[model samples]
Target: MAGGKLTARSAATTKPGTHGDGAGLYLVVSPSGGRKWVYRFTWQGKIRMMGLGSADVVSLAEARGLRDEARRLLASGSNPIEARREQERAEAGKPTFGAMADAFIDNKGAEWRNAKHRAQWTMTLREYCGAIRSRPVDEIDTEAVLSVLQPLWLEKPETASRLRGRIEAVLDAARARGHIPRNEANPARWRGHLDKLLPKRQKLTRGHHAAMPYAEVPGFVASLRERDALAAMALEFCILTATRTGEVLGARWSEIDMAGKVWTVPAERTKPGRPHRIPLAGRAMSILEKLAEGKTAEFVFPGQRAGKPLSNMAMEMVLRRMKIEGVTVHGFRSAFRDWAGNETRFPREVAEAALSHVIGDKAEQAYRRGDALEKRRALMDAWASYCEPPASNVIKMRKSGGGSAV
Candidate 1:
């Protein structure tokens, strides 16, 4: 009776409409009259049951095969229930590339100086690393990284190289944290690996410096002068004084001395961390005077909103409207240096001092203590004259030892 096959009618008669097969393996009849095959077994000293199949779908022989397989696994010291659970857990533990990248950025982005730099780092990763975004971080290999970087490598080498380094860092972090198995060789590294494959980036073409020629400056200034009631005046003032964009934009009324004709930028705002004394030229003073007229605010160029200086973009936008391309507002300092070197006879020290540039040798800076304000005053006057429309008659000027025009 244990081994014999019984017809459904005979089993039903013997069981009297009760719902289970006689053996440990059973066909349970539900209220709806559907029969399902289930097996009860012991694995690792614990009782367990595995559903073999629906009796309607699986033949008796097929259900026996499934039951035998489950029993064999249990007999071999494997807990079938636990094994299935672990398989599911392993699948869930695998992290997507996007998830890993976000983790990497969150951990590393705080080291950057500002929000702009942090934003750039994340944006590049999101844009170029899209292919592997959903792929498991543990499974990402050189080929996977290559698929993301290869297309942009030649066309945008700098961006591609940056993307590669960031991707490598993310994977390396994952590896260290046991999220992945090992430190996979970064496909993006240029020195030993990628450099062998791609053409080297030009060293000279690395950074952006937007400077304009000195010869074209007079015409540019003339064009700027024709524009009215714009931040072009402040930008032009910045050029005449040989100061920075931030210095001009954030300039307060308190810093300017109308009697002394000097603008002293505080040490905090200056790049060199030393207070800079700019000898205000006649043209620069004139512009400041115009801005001060009818303006009751503390800032010379106040923002449309109260208590704030002018927006940083205001001056740059003014330059763009003037149709002057390839020249940054900050690069005007370079233009001034070129003019001082080529057109005028001002000493290198005086010109450099005018730009608030830190000079060589700390000993020299300690020894040369004089600010040379009067001398700078005359030099600034000459610069202002040059910026103005040239008269038909030329005037010869002599240079003084203190860097003033005689």
Candidate 2:
């Protein structure tokens, strides 16, 4: 049976041991009558047996062809078995960018503070990075990254910056996992690489947010008073509290302590994943009291839909209706910050705390014990008075109570 092709009938009858069909190829027969093709070869003075295919599936001609291919590989000094394993490994390594990004998000998203941040990662990659999502991560180069970023770089600089960072992170993870070669330069790197190709974000000449002048906030509140919509009330509350729209919109009755005169923003609702107790000012409490009258819903500001809080855009719509062009709802916080800095004598730390901003480095923050709620209450009181001043003639009042001139 050695060194020649065996007929199908002869192969069927050849029971028991090994029968050869030429160069390093043999049909292995089990005592029970099972038969399969094997390619036997020697590389580096070591003999190896590699399975070609089952005789029932692979014809005698096909088995001979496989034998010839294996002989060629062995003649080239490459072990056929090792070569086939390398080819299998290469095929197994080809993962799409979308798949890699999903894995990265799943592994890292748990550390993120809020669901919205995680959602943004998926949305930005899917929406803005469609060009590279189906491509392999190792195959992504600077051109591929720039193709996703360039169009949005100037127009949506902030989003573009975030997208670039996300891509860099995913690529870094890919390299760490051996999906991509470690020596390959990350195409999304910003410092010395992408910065040369793309324009500096600061030079793009875009406003951070459309903020009304701090001096004009009182008059704006006065104008807001004339509107009767729930959104208007919510806007006024947001301005008075200097809170982000999502915090105010997601407010529930359970969070407010009427007796304590505080609104406890939970860790889940906050940007930093730390619970903050906002000292509700007299005016803020008054607004809540008004809303409480005959209100059966749990939300502080119920939306048009039942069992839901106000939409994120509700306050923005109120501003639009009033023809308050060039000012964003979120910008009111900046207005408050400016007012606190320029017109008030409160310490900068106190003012920053009022905004629920992370005040210092991790070490500094750890040493800082309380939120300075008493001081913030006084500051918020003064702020509410300034926004709803008895007279339109605005003047710097003498600092009073616990939050005195610093």
Candidate 3:
């Protein structure tokens, strides 16, 4: 205790003891000689000490004011310590846009089957939206979104479109978490809102993949057979099975069931993030047999590297070497789809399932769970037959208008 009743000058001079100002407010002095102001109070049979300020800095009058406020809070049944902590916690919960985006990616990345997909999510947002990363998520407005997207909207239409979708997803997630107040409309939503702000993305005259006309696929497959490279065999397998380039090149011997006559593409290797069962046709199985004669690696089509899959460009390079111009390896799937729609009696969903495409909306997909493997086997067999028509079935110089073949 201070020796006597203290004035401001006396409190400042008080050494190494707790000095009172006729109330719970006191000046605490340590033996090592530091001064601080504190308020002492009682609530519910407990004595609690609350720090006010250093006595050297806090005048006597200021300490009294703080002491009175603490008393008022105690009388009203609110603990000042708990109230401060709750306020601190609420502040801590508020995250800036960049921090929340990173958190969202980490949280959602696990569900994404591909590691590349997770990288793309972070890479796109960081590259495009660095400007608003430090801003509070609640303050990210339509103008901020437009500023990031407009530059790339026309310049890089596909990437910009995907970025807009990702941003919308992140914003919706933030809103759901109460990190941001819910707006009437999302700034990044495209349908009726952003469509007005930005110019429409130009529609392609041709499909995105440079597809050869379905009618020419048989002739093309015949030409592909002339080449004897491993890429040629891989491309033919891709065409016969109607599978993606990645799935065909990344194929492992273990994933193929020669007995069941099926190739199971795992979820990580597929676009739809689900395991797909491809009903192997005779031609597809034949190609696998040729490769299996003296297999050297885990991959069905191994690259120059010992155990790795073929390079992404290997099939495209094979087409280039064959002098096939203006076509992509991926375009074969489109050709298969077109032929299935136009020339075949197969149902559209069966064709879609053959290509491992997610048909229709979420509700439609939920109801149509079956992959229709048996029906797809028929469609694939027919497709294989069409790609390599038997010589006996090839009709030359058909007469027109009720005349027999010449």
Candidate 4:
């Protein structure tokens, strides 16, 4: 509980991620690069983050005061997160829309890709949403949301669209936290609610990243197997699992279930903000095994810095070093999809499930409760086999004549 390790200067300069301020208080930088104050504590064996406020809004001193308050609540056998919520209910007469938005950003810090993303959320919710900021979250009706959006809707189509989505997300989070009535339809809901009111702006056709042909993946993976560097192994695992770059880079040892042979991508770390369990085939497990040897950091693919995961650029640098051009790390998902659809007997839904794609509407999902984990497990195993045949054990290609290994 000793305090004051982080100075204002150090706090400002620290890279995007959490930094301890002692006594469970932390300065958390979202991947998009906004700063938030949080108190990390345990309740019944599960660690929870109690958001104090955004660092922009709450000074370090104020955050520490909030943390002390939370600590006192915890000492008195109360869960700080729940206690904080209760305190708000009794004292604040329901959280303001601005407060809920801040909380949503704080909670979603990890899922954001970078500083630009953080800025967009901050800008839209803070500057654009000024009209409704102080309004009680539960009272935020469709017109309140529309007033903030309509001005920018035609002038800045992309920004307005994203703002609408972010607002919807905040309302959704509000409903989840019981700040708003669950039965009340979201004021920012897109399809049935906003679609009728807001005219569809002209759309742009976004191109997918270039993909390496599925036929070429095995050879590319073999090239990857030739190196033992963390980035190389990380890239190989990314390809094998058909996961996103951020997911692989953000993967932590805590999320790995070696016994179950699965990597559980937590809700906060996923694009959809849903937990995804990826089955690890033997080849993928072998990559993890290689990295696990002598691994001491929390991140399985540890970066050069102590206790940090590899930089977002690290795997891309691997591709650059290999002199491979045209294809992207994400494009591997396309290759995997092509292979699954073209070569295998697996159902399309099973293939999509393997990629953690959300399929079907709420009603269909309700009836089809299972994630098809077992079927996907078999699908992933076959995909892994295609990438690197199990019998060879990913034979390393050592260099000849005193050169670096291939």
Candidate 5:
């Protein structure tokens, strides 16, 4: 304990140690700067320290009053700390967020496609989730998750989005392992949860979007094919090619090479501002062919305007049309990424290039300048097949009038 009695000013500035007051009341600052008020006293002839509250929340005067109460109880041969414990009846604490995150990485890290994946998880949890790292996994609520996200959510949207996803993943693992109650909804959940609170992430992302779980994409694709709108086709095309919304909407016939089975997105339309050559999957080719016939406009998915491409909100409207909930058009890229990373054997570089993300340090990026087109083509093909509509729900696309349910 520090030798001198602490005033409010000294207590706030005190370094990591126990700062004392006159009669067993103290402010204990941990190495991480977490300060708590404690009442040090004798309980049943053994020394005991009872937590009053966090120093941030509890005042020195209140702590002194609590110390006085403890002294009163001590004179009466009662242990104030044990009495408080009995009154509170606190639950046994579960594993902390940091410990759970460490376990999650150790268990799931091997399944990740790249070594950097582990590093990303580790760094995000350690740096971004520091507020909740010491909190029990079960104790993490929406407020706690929001505390970690709200500050970074705007300025560093990409990092904030990734950190939220990682937190959700660890909490999900905790739930599945029975660390949390089975019926408890995850606080870090994005759709219908955090999306309701934070700024719309679509406008903030750098072509990287919040993802729907990959396992549900195929079913969602099947639902999309049932619609007849051009916007529906555009959304499906975005998924099949694993390209961004603007890239899919802004595509022109000139960019498509039917013979080569490729679509060359010009530098202007891409996220990285570099021309990207995407090999067409058979499903994607079919989508192009279906949209091509009886097509009079230059843009693949044209708006009602004289020569303009489809409005960016068109696909989002398609979601509303279908009454689909909790999914976004750009999120398909993330779903595609998740599928490639976890379910496929394709190397991480191929998947990254397919998404137009120029990963790796400068030299590694320079060495990987080829874009790994053919390898990515294979990966895209596999992903396309994975997203194939269920046979029972197939709605054939007629060349003239769009999709028909017959």
Candidate 6:
């Protein structure tokens, strides 16, 4: 076989036959009238063959160019097929963590139960794990991972912990697919390295709820009541329903069923990635009704821009305006949970369900779907009554065992 250029026009003129060019290259003409370029070569002292492509697809000039390149690789003691694969891998190595993360998110975002979860995954990777986002996955190391977490390890331990774990998971996935090496110790694992460096987080304090006292809740609610606007209404609704900030901010009017007197938060909005039914208490309904009165926007709390939800910081600003310090908007859910557990007679499961929290064993949570909206309604109604101005007859219980009824 000899190597040379073969044009479509020349290929058409050739008779139906197989002929060699010089080296190991050949032009094969089929009976049905198809033309192709084939390369016959010796690799590792063994006969090898490869197709350059069709004369139409790979021009005669392109085929010769590939053959020349393959010959050069062969001279360098490399198998042409393996060399070609290596070249392909080198081209693919350009994808950075940020790029791969985007691709992964695009394919997997739909599988997430809610928009918040999807957003959190991307946001944390982009904002917190800055080193890994754009750097190649294979290049990520313990030091690189520590750069992202070390600064916040003590101050924002929980967030830092989650960011570390997520980064480890991303890298582990890349490693599993042979994009990187395996058995890399997770830089985020606290049990060994991080724990040795940082102060130990107390076990008793691990799950301690950071919430404002109930005694201060009325003052906070009263302060919020003075504000009049969609943001205010949304915040009030959040407080009444004991929902998260994202849930309240992202809520749409369509989710509220006025006829059914219920607000059904879809799985995408709920924290547990499941749908939650909230029985609209009289107060919560009133808040919604007032906001819906002559309102044309689709969002429960419409922003200044058309078709957009209210800013995420709207409720946080409300808390700040009330001069409440050291309390996050999210901590309000904790406050509600505290009130429900200590101040009300509602069952633990009912309170947990009202918060859209997954409780008990994983199997138990998997089996439980309903949010016990009716029971929650009663609890919310009582909560609303407590938050409202105290009635004249409502008595204050004494420190002693017995006290006069209201």
Which model scores highest in lDDT? 2
Q: What would you estimate as the lDDT of candidate 1? A: 0.69
lDDT of candidate 3 over 187-243, digit per residue (tens): 889999998888777752322566677777777777677678889999999999988
Q: On residues 1-406, what C-alpha lDDT tens digit does candidate 4 reach at each position?
A: 4358898778777899889989888999988989999889876456888888889888888888888888887776566675555556658768888889998888897798975466557655765675677677998999998887786565456767988999999999999999888889999988988988988865532346567778777777887877878799899989999997767877888999999999998765665556789999998898788778856557777665333467656776787788777666777888889889889999999998877777899798778767788899999999988987335555443221111100
The clash number for model 3 is 1
Q: What TM-score does structure 3 among the candidates reach?
A: 0.50
Model 6 residue runs over 4 Å out of place are 1-106, 109-209, 391-406
Error of 5 at 191 (Å): 31
What RMSD, rounded to one decimal, does every model reach? Answer: 23.8, 21.4, 21.9, 14.7, 22.5, 19.3
Better of 4 and 5 by TM-score: 4
Worst window of 10 by summed lDDT in candidate 6: 397-406
- How do the residues 1-406 of candidate 6 rate in per-residue lDDT, one tens digit apiece? 1345554477657877886664677778898889888778885347888788887688766777778888876665456775564456568775566666667678778998877788677756654554455466677777777777765455456766777777766766676667775666655566777677656656212433345665566656665666776677787788788887667777788898997888887764554556778887888888888877746556777665434466656776776665666665556677777788778888999888778777899798678766677888888888877666443344332221111111
TM-score of each: 0.47, 0.51, 0.50, 0.50, 0.47, 0.51
Q: Which ranges of candidate 4 are over 4 A from the true structure? A: 1-205, 389-406
Query: On residues 1-406, what C-alpha lDDT tens digit does candidate 2 reach at each position?
Result: 2237788788878879999877788899998888999999865346789999899899887888888887877665456775675466458777768778989989999999877687668666654565566677788999999987886676457878998999999999999999888888899999999999999988885756567877777777777777887889898889888887767877889999999999998775676557889988888998999999846567888754334566656787787777777667777888888889998999999999988888889899899979999999989998998888447555432211111111
Locate the minimum summed-lDDT window of 10 residues in model 3. 397-406
The CA lDDT at 397 in model 3 is 22
lDDT of 6 at 32: 84
lDDT of 5 by residue, 1-406 (tens): 2233778798788899888887788889999999999988765336787898998998777778878887877665456764554344335546778889999989998998765566667666764575577677888999999988886686458878998999999999999988899899999999999999998877774533445677777877887877787888899999899887667877889999999999998664555657899999999999889988857567788765434567656787787666655556667777888778889899887888898887889888777658778898899899999998667745432211111110
Candidate 3 lDDT (Cα, 0 to 1): 0.76
